[model samples]
Target: MKKHLLLLSAAAAALLAEEATLAPVSVVATGVEESVVEQPEAIAIKEKPEIELDQVVFQKDLFNSLPGVRIEQTGSVFGHMTAIRMPINTGPYYLFMQDGIPVQSSGFFNHNGLAYTTFGTAESVEVLKGAGTALYGSDAVAAVIDVHSTPAPSEKRTFLFKGTGGMYGYGSGLLEASGPAGEEGGYFANVHYLHSDGWRDHTQADRLEANGRYDLAIGDANALKIILNASKTEAQQADSFNDYANITDRSKAASDDPNYFKALEYVDVKRKFDYARLSLEWSNFSFENLDIVTTPYLRYNRNRYIATWQPNLPANDNELTTLGLLQRNTYQADWGRVIFGFDTEYTRSSLTYDQKFDIQTSGWSAAYYQAGTIYDYDVDYFAIAPYAHLEWNMSDKVVFSAGLRYDYNKFDYTNNLEDDSYYYALTSKGQKAIYYRPGDRTDSFNHVSPKASLSFMPDATTNLYIRYANGFRIPQASRLYSMKAGYETVTLDPETSDTYEIGLKKFFARHTFVDLAAYYMNIDDTITRYKNDNGDYYYANGGSSIHEGVEVGAGYAFNPSWRFKIAYAYGYHRYDNDPKYGDNEMAQAPNHTGNIRLFWTPWQFPGFELMAEYIYVGSWWFDDDHEAGKYKGYQLGNLKASYRYDDHLKLFAKIDNVTDNEYAVMARYAYGKTDYTPGDPALAYLGVEYRW
Candidate 1:
């Protein structure tokens, strides 16, 4: 098995050397544009293709084909997660950006945040693995996903439209155009619409988005780019199932609730998001040897969600508005290049919940009461971060890099309903109302992260690196403010991680590329959620944990007509110290995962292209204790076919889970019950496009 894997990696590394070098310029690693091969760290680039990216209308599967990455999707609908280098799903472990701007406010937790972002207008994507906090600040512990918008085409004018319809009433339409705005300016714009009657009961989706960008050049040293985007999404949530053994009906809801959401089969999410950004960049505009870049941005989001709790559930209205700035300067020197960055953000958020029914006590016994206002709060969050990095090109065979970042964060919270009081039941002393008035408070934290790396090149095609990086995540607002019953606001410490890694990148024969990475991480003060015997929830630090993993990926071109790629990852993630769950495997930490893909273009068939892929995920644990039965491992196969037909027209079709396999993409335990969300069954889509 080991020998076979070696041969596969060698061949896989050989497939896409030229394409990897296509864009040549990227800005993800150090916030500066440079050739990809010049970076000392591990980074992968994914370009949009002429055909559909996946069987579904959404681009959730965009990175699943890559190695060391896993995106656990839910029931072929919305709910999704990004796991790279980290084992956990929902937390401050990952960061998502568009044109280097954050898609959402940091420390905010939303499972399906990707559903609202625009991807149709993107030119390419870059994924960076391991610790990025040395430059990214908070929430860059595991990985970072950056989406770069397409640059305006050189043509005088260009227009394109794409449409698709397929199984389950799936439909999609997109219109895009790019060209010169005038003599010295360029613009790109697009609008997209997608809807689907999901595969299961009470699950459907509708979303619309519009995005535009303008680029202007001012003389020899200054450039400006403006971006605007808006999106509206109405989607139903298909929650996971609790009974893992009895899934007789796959299309039904896992739990039966008598609330308005369940009775009328209403939606779980109704949201509107708008964003605007202006970037001013200067090359040789600072001192004789320095370049400076600055970006100022704004974001707004208004959303309402139906509470999924049992009994008389109410709705929550939330509004978040933010203003931010990112400024960076790089100095060119004979010895090495040095970069300095300063970032700041101001956010105002308000949340109001109405008529939430809770178990309260009128006297000595337990009672159920409908509370008028469970929570009404507003907060102002602020962050000021600064970082510096140095890239030293010692010689043709050796490169050294180091960086350090400091983040200062503060939150000022105020309760709008300070006078509003409520009584709670299930208290340890019988019946006691939790402190309904949290009053006003100010909290702050400071964290510093540092990193260093050394790279050696045996030849131009092979690069090896050893590095150490540190990252940390500040506590989420919800964890700090959402006090229930007897639990009060508990002062929390940030979660910190120290990682040591060694990796290799090789591009041989100019047609093959391969990469392998292994890492060990030690994390302290990992926060976990729990419920006491009285049913109130609290967050506490789970002493320590250990995560270690190995990843391999390769690509090779068999000939002018064929190409192949493969990726695999294996990891052991477990708790190092915790009272009851000591040494238990963490939930949702899949240990073994892999993907294999083959692409073919027949010599006789002029415009025909075909692709086949197989995916596998090995089970880790369902709960902290690890479930009892069933094989946690499963495999799936997907296929894609396309015909270019002509320069102005094309057609494509894709099928996922070709064998109709049954598996679980996400599983966990909640309220003492094990729950799992089954993977998507076989699904297909067909589409056509026209460009001029």
Candidate 2:
């Protein structure tokens, strides 16, 4: 690892010596457009050109290139878990959006929520690290990611087609079209399909998605933009392998031991997801010195999957429908600016859990779960947030910003099943109730978050800033109502976090760009799963946790023909004042990670480009207990090349995991054994793109 870092540093130094110019860029994820060198936030962006150059097939492939960001693929198409300035986790810690519109309600956060968006059709993707600004509401604690759709072509009509095939029976096709309508309108539409016979057993998956956008000029100073997206995904979920030998084999579906069987049997275990959304944006309407933007959206999603990781194989079917609106008004003056906004959403959701058949095994883990309906419930969620932001330009060299937001969330939960204990069994101690159902209840919570930042610009191309922000996540309905052993009622507090960060952005000689940031976050009232002395599990509010990290990203455009880029981060995450795991390193949190890439467009060969990338992940503990020891991380190499054959045709090829190193994407200790999810092996892809 040290040698690789040294090599990357040397290459960067070499590239920095050359003279070149990289045009200035702007960031638009903060509800406003501002130059990168002037913004006080830690932001990273991937534009369409870069996405096309890499032929990105998954969201992880694009996000892993950003600093302090790590995404792990879970052996299924579009199944990913994200980590940003915190431990790798799946919950309501991060917010996912499409063109500034939340794709899913925060009350129903899902780990695979990104799949609901049409990533393949994005014109740009932006990520804001640490706690989000006051412009966003709940579930914006660790990070916020927004995907922007491709704009319609105004000059002429164009069509694009792309096809690819790779190892592991992977294949995909895409069709896109954009054109001008009349004189003041345009439209863009696209459809994508992908299929993969996953490397692991029983993990075959397929997805189909479509996106459409239209822009209409309402008048000289106002416009309307409409967006539509839909997708459907189907897969056979994979199970973790408990044995080291089976992990390496890559073919085994479960452990060889007869005592413990994998969740999925020879019979197919189906997992399906369906999503659809419609949103309209009306912007740039000015009244006096104020400009207003309004957006109204509706979305629906449904997911059906088997609980493969749980001891009891309960099949779950969940659905959510959301209607939301966003209104913003910005007032500008000579000395400063004031922005005020309000966000409101109404969601209706339902969930059902069923255990198809009783576990025949005598293992203690599955003894309490019987073959029956575990839970059936319906929930209606309502949330409203109002926020205000003030930016004061103190002087030519300094700027001060402050923001405040108030959020009100309410949930009306109704139990469809009998409000009583469903099953009971005898444990080592005594007879105990295995499952408990609670009666209908209504709960509400209110929270206030305040944020402040100061920016100092010593020169035209350099900025230094310090920012502090507060964020929170409302408890989900299931966590608030679902009951387990020894409990008839459950109450969980909302998770809250405070973050302090210092950052610097610099543009040197218009050729090199650098961004550096260090942040510390303290989270309170963390919701954690607790196990009693009787070995029954339940949800509770744990103490707290601390996460601190430093991230650096730099790009040196030596010339138009040669460019070098790198992103590196080092993070520390640990439990703080927790009874179960005091001061212990968090699970799935790596110490360091880095990505380096070199792009070359040879002058000797016309319309030809080549890219080489190196990726590294540092070691980390397998679990919070640290009983299973550490997992020595791995490194990978990838290469990509493209050639434009003509004005309308192009050919591209890529090889990933070029060294064919075997590794695990995820690992943990459970059931007195270490379980692993194997990563992808060496894969090769070739594709053709046509445009007219």
Specify the highest-TM-score model's number: 2
Q: How well does model 1 score by local distance difference test? A: 0.70
- The estimated TM-scores of all candidates read 0.90, 0.93
The true-structure Cα RMSD of candidate 2 reads 6.8
lDDT of each: 0.70, 0.80
Error of 2 at 458 (Å): 2.5
What value of lDDT does candidate 2 attain over all alpha carbons? 0.80
**Count of clashes, each model:** 15, 0
TM-score for predicted model 1 compared with the true structure: 0.90
lDDT of 1 by residue, 365-474 (tens): 33454456767888899999999998888897898999999999898988887643553534445556743557778888899999999989777667788988998888
lDDT of 2 by residue, 634-668 (tens): 78999988999898999999998899877777787
Q: State the weakest 10-residue window (summed lDDT) of model 1.
A: 1-10
